[model samples]
Target chain A: MLIEAAHKPHERLGAYLKDEMAAVNALISQRMASKNAPRIPEVTAHLVDAGGKRLRPMLTLAAAKLCGYRGPYHIHLAATVEFIHTATLLHDDVVDESGQRRGRPTANLLWDNKSSVLVGDYLFSRSFQLMVETGNLRVLDILANASATIAEGEVLQLTAAQDLATDEAIYLQVVRGKTAALFSAATEVGGVIAGAGEAQVKALFGYGDALGVSFQIVDDLLDFTGGDAIGKNIGDDFRERKLTLPLIKAIAKADAEERAFWTRTIEKGRQQDGDLDHALALMHQHGALEDTRADAMVWADKAKAALAVLPDDPIRDMLHDIADYVVARIS
Target chain B: MLIEAAHKPHERLGAYLKDEMAAVNALISQRMASKNAPRIPEVTAHLVDAGGKRLRPMLTLAAAKLCGYRGPYHIHLAATVEFIHTATLLHDDVVDESGQRRGRPTANLLWDNKSSVLVGDYLFSRSFQLMVETGNLRVLDILANASATIAEGEVLQLTAAQDLATDEAIYLQVVRGKTAALFSAATEVGGVIAGAGEAQVKALFGYGDALGVSFQIVDDLLDFTGGDAIGKNIGDDFRERKLTLPLIKAIAKADAEERAFWTRTIEKGRQQDGDLDHALALMHQHGALEDTRADAMVWADKAKAALAVLPDDPIRDMLHDIADYVVARIS
Candidate 1:
């Protein structure tokens, strides 16, 4: 349906990629139908069917197709990626003790923590069983590595939370581990499972890694940018004492007054009603948001450049467009 | 060591196997050493050094040696198995909200729930990375399945707790998933990594499964029969409403009043002072403990028979002695 919108002026790549993503979503839903635990389907469907972007799974499916896969197993691979993603979200909600996700009530809040944890474990098991049925040990290796990396990332993020010494290097490591690893793995496995050559597989992973970095940087940037329609409020990262790119930059550029304010608000994690506005003003005054956006654009450009080695196809064009779409919102 | 005290009567098998199992203990301690995350080495040493029969890891090492594995990776595998077991204990303590393990404060109570959960996750990741370094896909597959089965078993046990209708069938499934799966995977992968034949692998798995089942049954029996020096007061499983072998057998043999007692104590999960004594008396009067001991002996015998299929060696003798050791108290 959004393909029609893609033809319009200033239309985004998501509009063009809607149908393929919907196929991935449908596949995910079908595979998530559990027989033993009735609660599993209910809880999993609640998160899976929630109207968030199926970006990761779509990336997996798109990568496989771009590598000239004609088999139906890509559907299973996409579903597996989505299941692992959804399961992580369920556990994350419990771990973060957060009430909202993707602008909706989190699973732990809606159901209970026990259900979130147990159901998350169940989905993980189900995901493994699904991958095992593929009989592709390489895929198993990739996905299991991704699962372990994702869990480690969450643990790192937990440890890094509210710690002011969390510099750019550790921050990048946290982001790469938490977000980029799965993205890279998803696309890389897609290429591997589709029987792509080593070079193309490497390119796909590079593209995915760059795209994921761009996506996360843009997301982090939006927290300070104050875009109401995008569900990002002003200084959200600062309010949470999350040392995003802009904040780290701003901290480096802090004047005496700014340093004092940041030390009290960000470092001490003590914020007031006007603290968000103050933080946003500091970020703008220091040009940190602009710097973060520029960094994101650099990654987006790298993602597009990685496609130079691949053979031309509509999927390649779409991937390039998707990379641009990642940074488009920040601009 | 208890080997010296318990082996006084059986001078032959006891002292020799004691030295062998001591090697297993030394291997476990050596492998559990960590350079990162000081808490890891600390929390792990707390449990690994806690006095218990190193039966499971010994089974793994013995199986590997019996299959002529000269490689040092078996030590890593043995430690990996123990780490997984310890990690699960940490998470299980939090989930069960238990206060005591080995008559000492649980990690949850001692360290905190957060430490328990995150440390459990850390050990899990470490184990995954360790197995990956093994570069044996079959070993990875076996261990991954064991992990899922272990989690599923824990969930199943959580659901089955205090549910009186949880009969021997579901009980056995839980036991298989929780205990036998890991035990079998430990021994099975030992044979696998050693490049043993399929028949040998299957026999090792069978031996471990029977050994684990018998060991768990004896543990449950000890909860009812063993005195405080063993070390808790009797009927710990009854107090916890765990529908173990003894309880399952007693539920079957129970009459109307006995059924009512179980319904109130286990199904309703209500217990008063002296209820443990009453439960033990019922277990005696109904011959439930006797039946559970018989079932455990049958499994021990089956384990010995499974070992009979393997080639005769000192490890084989130790395997047989381990099986005998499992039910030695009950017999």
Candidate 2:
């Protein structure tokens, strides 16, 4: 466990696919350039250079390599995935009205919401252009559907985020839309581009879907347990009135008094200074945090189990380890 | 000319392509719906049902019919174009912080910016899905590039909207990005999907591009001369401090004293009650409005000339007449 902790799954996968990742980065840089609107590039570069792990695109590369196929289009697909992710982040910051991201002032905060919105649209169109260049209709279908699902999920979250009645089912749907849709699409496109068979492609999709669910679950968990290492301040989801998994679980089992407290603080937005601590205490009383952590591990295990059908390869092994690592954060 | 004037080009074209346009409209209505997020359809239905002429989609239908298309995909392409146009308008309203559009309250005003932005994204993704269903990569490329160009043009307009240094060249670029790129794509994709010859396709592209330019020039001109007939208040552009073509021309010829007035009213956005009238007087002093009118005519003529390569079909004739009608609004 210590050795596994020391050598992270993403770092291992990144080292293995270093050259392909580099090409994806180069493409992202080249394509994000605007001949006329310098603000587009300025805003894009601020977020792009904020040092995200590039985890989504690596999933694309790893899936393609594991399929034992070689193609130039994977780089295009990988870059397309990254651009879509970045564009979503830009718009998400605006939607969330976030002031900080990745330990830096968000583009919306630094430049303005207008720049973030327009630049995000530019990046989205840019992603479509890159994907269309591959001339793969299937790839276009997956990514385009994923984009729509992501948007739909976001709209769902907008309406459901503050509603305490937003149950575990709605939470999973939002998680799938906002996070897992892109992950599954990224991996599925790689296999489709590499001409992988139906079984292998399904496995890749299943792996990505489960992994993404685990990743988001862990992210929501970290908003409670994440120290400064996570960059984001703790209790963000709670303060924002986001009814994530833990809160949903807690609310499900709350007594009449506890339900009133949640209704006042969350639904009514009448939060006080110690509301977070009280919320945490309620979560502890219900064992919601531990239960949420257990759920994330179940998802990670599903992700790993899904990969068993794929061929045995170093890249495949890295993907398996990635699933484990995602839940490891919570553990 | 009087009879031709009584029967406007879009109405005639709409009559000619009535069934196709109806199908396109139905498809649009069906696709804008959300299974989970009811807000997506609500906001979209508001703007989609608004009385705008649906001119861009009509261009696609007209182009396809002129190119002798008999396939079912033109309806898909037409709906796709409308979706793209509608999405841009949604985002544009948010960017401009606009309250009204097409004489009605904007989606952003009725709903929130968050709803507008997310719903706009949903429409864009829906448009892409529609276009990809055609399996024509060229159409995808054209529409995707146009989308990128539209976004770039918008960002350029944002930065240049208040700057006095924005010239005629930049204004044209902004106009092309904001208006013509989609027009050209709408028509170009129709021809591409119809398997039109290169010359015919180029002619279609040229016609749409010129028509879009003329359309926007007239829109800008009407802001000053349109009175209440144009639905929007006169001087709205001046109030917004948008440096449209006429104002750009007038500012170019400003004397030292007039330059200060222009700077204070436009560049610095310090407008008093009589400022719009003063700006109009300045434009008159320099013949800016007349010159702008002349420019619109030039573009209309260019649009007519671009149709020379196409067969002399009635749809082609209506397209040529539509170009004239766009400019006729100002004349």
Candidate 3:
């Protein structure tokens, strides 16, 4: 029901969000336009213009309005969240040695790793400065914790990657750290800076966290069972040897032959040309992709459940729709 | 006169400091010891155990007592300062791609760059958690500003390195950002959390800033004139193509041939063996090292002047001696 309303009535919500986010974007462009360092703007704009969905900032704005926030600090807090997100992306590309991001050459690849690392540090410093301008110690506490969690999640993922023993519990931790932490913090701080009550704040945080977890699970599952080649490639995780939910489930369900195949391809990270087809077949045989999708829908339902405490509003319906869109790509 | 106190009868500040710093070190060691991740302690303690005077934490302790602080937060602040310092060093080594740090293999070399970067992030997060536990917003502001300044300083240093046109002003900016920002913040927070008056906090910041400036100048000067490998390698800055004080000062006073030598060797990073002697001779010929020493003394005197507002105490006298010790190697 929420999904149907979101699809039909969300155009108005989108328009309102576009204007709200434009202000945040304008502030970011203004702050990022460093006169002293010409190279900073050049590199920072390269990543900023790469066009993320601006989901985090939008969450901040949405949560702020939902809680009856009347102050202007939410805009600043939203911008702060966006900066931290961008800074982490810059650093993440370098850490992951990722050559392409958003289907464009990453800053690390286009420039040098040195510039990426240093400029990321500059953005981080700038983000903190922006947060300080808000004069909210609670906001700082939230953002700082989010940053630490993001970093810990990254370290955990790094260690967990390629390890055969990584189970769903560790997988969940990594996904939460890598994705949910920022999402929850973004929405949580929106409520906090708005001076929302504890229940509203906690509701918003739960909504963001469940939505984040669902989003990541869908992304992971889409790598296996995406209906179209344009939507998701087959066995991207296998080639990278990333132990995602589908693969972990398949491994648990694998017979001797399938186990041997995974041991050769996944553990060794030496997949052959036809390995993608073989992996997909194995996943289908075990119904692992379907299971992962079910898990994601469960989280989406949990996300929708979190809004029970909030007053009925169009933005709340849009939030539910966004969670559906996250899983709809799998269909 | 403060330099002479090193040889004269006085309070046992160094021995007393050793005991105080031991407590700080114990706290750092305890925090760094990760149960699930043994690599955390291994990498952190490697650098923590590497011998340095723990000068930053010592400044925090000394400044706290000088401002009549008797609280337990000083210990936390001291440990927080050191954690920040160590985190920066870990990242700096990765950025510089340096092999040796304080005569030991760098964290990057010892445990790989990924480990160094992630572990550095861990320490940064730990430092934030420690400061948050203090529950002092002012102290948090002081430290968060310092973190930004430190990162910015590193970026400035990176940009300024290898640019021969970098002047004394730029060099001072780099030095202030990279080295002195933390020093001032460390002491400023010490006085602040101790509930010192505004004037006292300002004085403490001034003391730390001056001492930091003198300390960096002495470090630069020692790279040119320190004998017997007792100091870091002569012209290590030159080898790295870093535009340190002596090099910038020498360039200012250089004749055409000397300038050409710098352009080819330092700027181009094309120095061969025996260039160290030639470079040292050029420094002497232009009185660049001597000029740098003059700058150090100016900062030292300024540091002593900062103590003028403080009540006369043995700690104040010892503070003066410490500033003197920073440049003592050059003398």
- Model 3 chain A: lowest-lDDT 10 consecutive positions: A1-10
Taking the tens digit of each residue's C-alpha lDDT, what string does model 1 give over B1-331? 1334345323344344465556556755654554323455677677666755555666677788789888867766776787678877776766767778777878868776555665666566566556656767788778877877776677677678888888888888788877998899889988998999989999999998898888788888888888334437666678889999888888888899999999999988778888777888888888989999999999999988988678898768767776777777776
Order the candidates by lDDT, highest first: 2, 3, 1
The regions of model 1 sitting more than 4 angstroms off are A1-39, A70-73, A110-112, A129-141, A226-240, A255-273, B1-54, B71-76, B101-105, B109-115, B226-236, B254-261
On DockQ, the stronger of 1 and 3 is: 3
Candidate 1 is scored at a TM of 0.85
**Candidate 1 clashes between residue pairs 3 or more apart in a chain or in different chains:** none
DockQ metric, candidate 1: 0.25
Q: Give the per-residue Cα lDDT of candidate 3 at B317.
A: 86
A306 in model 3: Cα distance from truth in Å?
0.7
lDDT per residue (tens digit) for residues A128-155 in model 2: 9999999999999999899999999999
> Each model's RMSD to truth, in Å?
4.4, 1.3, 3.0
* Backbone collisions counted per model: 0, 0, 0
What value does the interface RMSD of model 2 take? Answer: 0.6
> Cα lDDT of all candidates, in order?
0.74, 0.91, 0.81
Q: For candidate 1, what is the lDDT? A: 0.74
lDDT of 3 by residue, A1-331 (tens): 4445345333545567787788899989987765545667888999899876788888899999888888888888888888888887877877777567776888978877666776777777677777777777787888778877777777777777777778899899889878999899998998898898999889999999999999899888877765545423566678888899998998888888888888888787877888889888888888888899899999998998998887688788888777777777675
Better of 2 and 3 by DockQ: 2
Q: Which candidate should be chosen as best, given DockQ against the real structure?
A: 2
